[model samples]
Target: MLLHASFPFLKEASYLASIYPQIYLDFGLRIPKPNFHGLMSSVKEILDLAPINEVMINSSGITFAE
Candidate 1:
């Protein structure tokens, strides 16, 4: 499932994904919007609860300008 920017829901999402083999997480808008530390912390939180393979990187269709 594609999750959006909901910091508080991180734990729940992780827990659910861990139990449900079909459930997946997308680190899209949530990652880029946070500060460096916040981003790292968020990723750590997810990793602590879910397996690495269950997570997926989402670009959110956003491109950076040079």
Candidate 2:
């Protein structure tokens, strides 16, 4: 899927946090959350980085490679 939030719902949600915290209560928007861009960046980093096994081998020694 294309990396992004749930379209207009999240778009409108952006305003809900600032403009109307009360709207959150009205719409059950609890626990104000991070945005799609933040989440996407984190996911991208994980996908870009080598696996932990590879990292361990590189950082320590080949004997402990997974």
Candidate 3:
């Protein structure tokens, strides 16, 4: 099972992912949004509970061109 768009629920998603072995987190559209500090903090928050392997990144095959 995957928790989609986890950026909006970093804490909850991370916690769930940490507790459930079959659960994974996906931070869709999150890659291009945050700056260095924000990105670091977000990752830190996730890693605080969820394992690195349980966290996934998916762009949904969509790109934001600016």
Candidate 4:
């Protein structure tokens, strides 16, 4: 869900060849693949942060409107 530049995948990702063989020798396509354990560990750390973890599990969203 972390689509921003701060996503760990971006940091570790390197340019890779395209899935299909390149027709032209100019360049190749690249895609980002995450280090799954690294990403999950970060998420686990955030979830362990306290009552935020508990509230997050039971609630859909919070609203201030009355």
Candidate 1: Cα lDDT at 40: 78
Winner on lDDT between 2 and 3 is 3
Candidate 4 Cα outliers beyond 4 Å, as residue runs = 1-34, 50-66
Model 4: residue 37 alpha-carbon error in angstroms: 0.3
Off by over 4 Å in 2: 1-33, 51-66
**What lDDT score belongs to each candidate, Candidate 1 first?**
0.76, 0.32, 0.74, 0.28
lDDT of 4 by residue, 1-66 (tens): 122222343322111111212211111111123577754554444334322212122121244567
TM-scores for all predictions: 0.76, 0.26, 0.68, 0.26
Tell me the tens digit of each residue's lDDT in model 1 across 5-51: 24568888888888999988887754543577887788888888888
Error of 2 at 58 (Å): 28
Rank by TM-score, highest first: 1, 3, 4, 2
Candidate 1 ranges with C-alpha deviation above 4 Å: 31-33, 64-66
Who wins the TM-score comparison?
1
